[model samples]
Target: MSTPLWIFDTTLRDGTQGEGISLTAEDKVKIALKLDAMGVHYIEGGNPGSNSKDIEFFRRVRELNLNAKLTAFGSTRRKNSVCEHDVNLKHLIESGARAATLVGKSWDFHVHTALQTTLEENLAMINESLAYVKNSGMEALFDAEHFFDGFKANPEYALAALSKAKEAGAAWIVLCDTNGGTLPGEIGEIVSRVVREIDAPIGIHTHNDCELAVANTLAAVAAGARQIQGTINGYGERCGNANLCSIIPTLQLKMGYGCVSDEQLKSLTGVARYVSEIANVHMPVNQPYVGNAAFAHKGGIHVSAIMKDSKTYEHIEPHLVGNKQRVLVSELAGQSNILSKAQEMGLDVNPENMKSREVIDRIKELEHQGYQFEGADASLELLLRDAYGGTAQAFIVDSFKIMVERTGGAMVTEAIVKLSVAGEQVYTVAEGNGPVNALDNALRKALVQYYPGIRDIHLSDYKVRVLDEKDTTAAKVRVLIESTNFKDTWSTVGVSSNVIEASWEALIDSIRYALLGMDKDEYVPEFVGGTHGLSNH
Candidate 1:
């Protein structure tokens, strides 16, 4: 049996505080429901009194029977006002949540500089706020804002503030490294002292300014903190908060803590990607657990050894986190890697036909052109599928033209596509926010007439990168688009000097891949005798 640590997610609250993510109330609820399904124990919805969207989130959460407890967050009542009389208190009550969280000044400097209040007055406000929420029949949690700095600056006052929250009935007292400048050793010592002093369970909230948010969080956890508060993808003000996506896996697989079931942990990467999609944020490729590069092995020696025995290269099995090990074929990939990836994808290597060299040449050429197959295994699978004649094309793009213009320097891109499906010609025009979107929409619209199932598949992601950022004026760009049907998600890539041309190519391939899935009958036999079967090798 493994010890369970509570996961307190604040993606809806702190994550939205990032530069450009402001979801509507409906989007918030949708994300909340997804988070609940992912099995987080608690959700810090938002500060209800702060804005209409947050207030609406509380109202909507009240109407939901969410698996995770909804926690309404706000600050302690202002000085000179009783918690019961504070309008913020009334707003907290109106949230209709079963739990409440209140942040209070823990640093003496903040009490004097920010609040313009005496230390004694700040203590009173903290105690009064926690007591009022407890008396109102709600579970209360205290966020000791700037706690580390406060503890270091004035240990007695910080300890006193935490003691007040405990006396006032806060279930958990969270120590916040608000400025994100605290060292891990300092956090471990402080958390150890506070845990020893306070009877209540301790929680930790850390920011990433110094790039130690995850490190500090782990240190605090080791020091008796039972709850971890963070946002997915490390999103927040400034650099961001500790990323729960990274934290959860480290806790479960590496640290021997069980924050979630193995089944849920296996789908962790999928959940991380899913949330990023809803938030409309680009998934960071280098993110620890769920990132594309997490389990990707690029070297020939590493790939060969991993294929023989995964433990040779992998710290933990990739499947444990719903991610699979990938052999990245590039200029660096040797015959061993080409063989390994080909075998994994159920490709027929045919050494006699010298397919390895041909495949390696193609991969190198594609790499030179800025096509990264590492993040798009589905696209690679499709490539392998086509190379072996596993799946025949249902349609092919004959020609396409796209026009893009900006009104007042704002961009508007449109696509005109022509294709032949089953020897029948079709043409369509569509407009979109960008060239890729427009091309994708037009292609899908044209294909739907012959294949109505295309409607079931939708584009889930579109990523474009300038190949040479330093030479932007003369740079080429690459585009990768991920699409999903009811069952699986596949990524396809395109590259060209022109962004529009790259997007168009990727869009056409994306629709073609989706259509390929519909033609499973065509590839079932070819794969049966392929590398996935031992006899083929």
Candidate 2:
């Protein structure tokens, strides 16, 4: 039988520490509900006693009948203070949480320097805080703050702190790599020693300043930690905390741990994206497990090989993690790639009769001009349709004007748009926070008269990436626009030195493809029965 490891999510407590991210009580409650639905084992909510928002979050969550246990988090009582009277400790009880976590200094340096107390005083704090919570009928967990570095500096003292928490009735003694400076090798050795010395279950909380947060956390787990503490998307101070998104799949699929089942496994992608959305952060394209590029293949040889056997180019099946493998067609696409992508877009491609090389060359030419089709399959579909002479003009842009003005320290932008469809002219105007948004609104309004379904097509994602960061004001920026309707979602791209122009181009193509899809109801067939290619049906 495989080992069972529990996940402790700290997105509310630690994730909000990221720069420029501040979640209100309502926001935390919404995310907590989603996490509960995702089947997280525990949620380490923020220090309820530290702020009114967190106190309210706990008060509200108590009435939720949540699936996951809510753990109130804070530091241990101050030196020489009684845990019953310590405001931090009292706050935990009043916060209406069933579980509580208190972190105390384990490093000798932190004990003496940061807390301005003796080592014995810190140990007393750790002991009394846990005992008080345990006596109060709450599940108590002790965070051995900076335990990894502390173990390196003073192993005996740090282990003694764990022992104290154990005797005081901590459910788990969590070792925290607070500075995120510990390596996997060091963590393994330290955890091995600590696990042998303590009778309580061990946990690990890690940060990512050195980008090894996940690695070190996993190492500790392998060495005997039964609980893994991290945030959903790794939101926290500095480089952030260990990402539960990566840890969960790795434990279940790679490490042979039987914590989550196949049903819960399928929620991986949605969980990652849902967290990022509630956090109001753009999803990182390259994030592991659920990233858009995680299962995407682009190179010709790679795509061809993947078509023959997915294992040739993929670490694991995309479906295993609730994701699908994608074949990106651009300058890198070959004949097989063109056929594969065409099939994905529900188009047919006969290699012998089709202009496969011509399409590849055109894709390359457009790529050289900074137009990327990799993330924009809708744009690729339109290009293929145009190449096949199957596309028709939905609407034509005649002229557009943008105006910007500053009012009360706020920038007000407006757009005026004119269009000609089948020789008939139409014009519209709109106001927005930016010129590009104004143009998009105005264009969509004018077209809604001709195509009412345009109302269903809404922009879901917008990205502006600078081609060269060194070219400050004049750097070319690439814009990616993702559009969605009730049926499906598709992306389109554009590039220009002007950010607004690039956004406008992508936005226009996104809408065009949305309209184009409405006209084509026939499903394109895939050409299969090849022995040399990967499986596709």
lDDT of 2 by residue, 1-537 (tens): 888888899999999989867898998998888778777888888998888899888988888999788999988888877877798888888777878999888899999889998888888988988999889888999998999899899989999999999999999899999999999999998899888888889999999999999999889989999999999878899999999889998998899886567778877777777677667676677788888788888888988898789999888787887777788998768888887777676665778975888888888887886788888877777677656554445566778899999999999999998887656888899998788789889988888887788887777788888888899999998898887673455788877898887887778778777776676664221111110111121
All predictions: root-mean-square deviation over Cα? 4.8, 6.0
The residue-by-residue lDDT of candidate 1 on 1-537, one tens digit each, is 787899999999989999877788998898788778778899989988889999888887788899898998888998988877788887887888778889999999999999999999999999989999989998999999999999999999999999999999999999999999999999999999998888998999999999999999999999999999999889899999999988999998899898978887887788777777777777766677787777788898998888789999888888888877777766788888877777876667775676677767777777877888777666566555555554544566677888989889889888998877777888999998877678778888887888798888888777788989987767888888887663456677777788776766666566666665676555432221111111221
Clashes in each model (backbone N, CA, C under 3 Å)? 0, 6
lDDT of each: 0.82, 0.82
- Once all C-alphas are superposed, what RMSD does model 2 give against the true structure? 6.0
Off by over 4 Å in 1: 351-353, 366-379, 403-414, 433-436, 450-453, 456-491, 496-500, 517-537
What is the number of residue pairs that collide in model 1?
0
TM per candidate comes to 0.89, 0.87
